[model samples]
Target: MIRMMTAAALAATFPLAAAAQVAPTATVAEGTLLDVVAEGRVNRVPDIAVIRAGVVSQGATAAEALSANARQMASVLTALKGAGIADRDIQTATISLSPQYRYAENQPPVITGYQASNSVSVKFRDIARSGTILDTLVKQGANQIDGPSLTIDAVDSAMDEARVDAVKRARERAALYARALGMRVDRILMVSEGSDGGAPGPVPQMMVRAEAKDSTQIAPGEQQVSANVRVRFLLK
Candidate 1:
């Protein structure tokens, strides 16, 4: 569902300084000014899912840990490719080799083992197949996984819709104010965009197990795309 809200204030005079700050091209006309702030929102189901998948390996030496991690990560990448993920959708996110330490009562910390990790960010255009592919990645040696951030792949259309709604709301609000003040709206002096963005719904991180019998399920509920606009109307 789409929602719209508007707040308006009537002013006898508009300061030229404030008008210049808000919109450089705005020209202050000779009339009572009505400023309206309107917000429009559209709710939509997410079409894309982004997840981070990786492998972690530990060994006595850094070389051994890195080698093991590399081999495991290779399998994970192969699994993703086999699942119809394009190379452009997969990006290497992190890679590191760190020393694991062991502390004693009165001695300096000693190096116990080395841990190596490699992770990649994967964008799944098909939301329905993401859960199953995640399960397959885990079975193919991915031990570390994060996210599944649901988002709208194509947001331009939604944003344009919201913008139109905001403008319409602003015009109605200005008309209402003009009527109440025993005046008529002559013309719109200026319009400027305020805070505008899409808010994605929160999704919990999945705790996947290789031995689990149940299949992983991903649910992308709904996200809201919003647009805010400030409009100035001349009342005569």
Candidate 2:
């Protein structure tokens, strides 16, 4: 005769087997990792203008050349001050006195005279008045000039905005990838920032019309600040 086993008896006889069957099996599956890079940019009007103003003078001797350069540079400094430029904003960039050499076909090079140069980097907080200041510098003996590099004086806010945009774009891209691969985005595992294009650099110099009848005009177009980011996401 066969005897039917009750539930309690089955549990007692095969305790481990019964526990395995009823144990929770809803564990989250391992997700596929993905990495994506994205870039974001912000455009804004520049607030400041940087320009290099310099004087070059030549004389028969080094002392004379330096003296002439000093006189001219003094006038340039005075002009800058008259235009309301702060003393801290004017920084000496270059000061040099080199011997002028005359190259000969057969004989050795001869020192004909000396050339001296003095330059300062000037930062103009007022973009609208920078051109007028530049013209005044020219009239005051600043012959060698370069750059009116337009840039935002305070870029921290703009950079932050760009960074946020970069993260947003990265997330969107990651979601798109997850959808394409028939999966859903689980979470972001890691995030890292890359290059920041908002940092200022040496901008190429443009032509300055100092001799024009009207005052010099400076047009600061929109400047772009960019940020790059790399994100790692888990998709399941």
Candidate 3:
């Protein structure tokens, strides 16, 4: 959710200027100033999936481990491309080679073997194929799978809606306050927008891996986007 926030300092910052509206000699204009803060939130169905997949291989030597990991990772990348994943949508996330050690009670740790891992982050624009693609990746030797985080690729429209709602709420609150004080809103003095969640609210379902035989159910749950705004109204 996006919300608008303001502190008493805001009004204090321009105390002299605001007081000038009433009279040069007036000490305060409490009845003539109205401020309100409000927040708006909107929900939308996610249309994109972010999948992090990788391959881990172990061997007796560092080179052997790296070589095996490379072979598996290559197959995974090839499978992703064959499934229509573009190069730009795929990014190398991590690559590492670590030595395995055996712990002994009466002796120092001994080097046992070497393990190599490589991971990539893949963005699936087409939600329908997200599950199928993931399944294919696993079959193609992706042993280290992390997430299928869901999100909406384009959030401009949803963000606009939230902003509109926030503005509406702020105006309503200002009007209510003015009416309670036996005054009417003359005009909007200032309006400030607040920060938003940017991306979707939550990672709805963080998928680790798909079940065997059954198709992966990539459920892109409804995402909530919020906006907040603060408004200062000139009352008469």
Candidate 4:
């Protein structure tokens, strides 16, 4: 019985001794490794614009609603072509026909009418006239206007700017860390990139009623395009 008790005590103390032996190695490995992060941001002016414009018509029948919507949208397309929008720049985005419902206190929901809507995506090369174009569209018959989401069509330049900024930031960090630890930075052990996720500028909304004879007011304020990047550097 005494021998068995001694064996049990030895078994319990073995793990404690092993844990004490392994603790120092883990601490040393963690101390020698360092992780660094650097961020870069750049702002540029937007050069391209995208607009979503469409027509909405409602009538007693689905065919009538769809016909009315088609007629008005055709006129809108003609006006856009006259203003220099290329064929490739215009695309039909949506066409939806839904029944209009009316409810009464004592009766089941009745189909009162039907509505048809069609939307188009328009890209503008000349941003100066974007507002004027909106005004023209409303004057013609466009009832639904969604956006003028601004963008920088050529993103390569913006990406280049971000890359340069990232390099500068990484170098600045490496110098700071080297100074602090009294060690010199040798070379970049690894370089990995994090995308900025295609930065979009801004989208402003403009509203116009069909009853208005003249074009709606347009205001295209300055839009800011931005880019971001993260870089990691190693030290010796």
**Model 3: lDDT to the true structure:** 0.76
Q: What is candidate 3's TM-score against the reference?
A: 0.83
Candidate 1 segments whose C-alpha is farther than 4 A from its true place: 1-30
Note the residue pairs that clash in candidate 3.
1-226, 2-226, 2-227, 2-228, 3-227, 3-228, 4-228, 4-229
Whichever of 3 and 4 has more TM-score, that candidate is: 3
The count of residue-pair clashes in candidate 4 stands at 1
lDDT of 4 by residue, 9-67 (tens): 22122111111111111212112222344455567666677888999999899999999
TM-score of each: 0.86, 0.76, 0.83, 0.75
What is the number of backbone collisions in each predicted candidate, taken in the order shown? 0, 0, 8, 1
Highest lDDT model number: 1
What is the per-residue lDDT of model 3 for residues 1-236, given as tens digits with 9 covering 90 to 100? Answer: 22222322233532222211322233334436666668888889988888899999999999999999999999999999999999999999999999999998999999999999999999999988987888888888887877777887778888889888988988888777777878787776666676676445456454445346877777787888887776666677
lDDT of each: 0.84, 0.77, 0.76, 0.65
TM-score pick, better of 1 and 2: 1
Which structure is stronger by lDDT: 1 or 3? 1
Q: Any runs in candidate 4 off by more than 4 Å, and if so which?
A: 1-35, 198-202, 210-236
lDDT of 2 by residue, 21-96 (tens): 2221343245566667788888888888889999999999999999999999999999999889999999999999
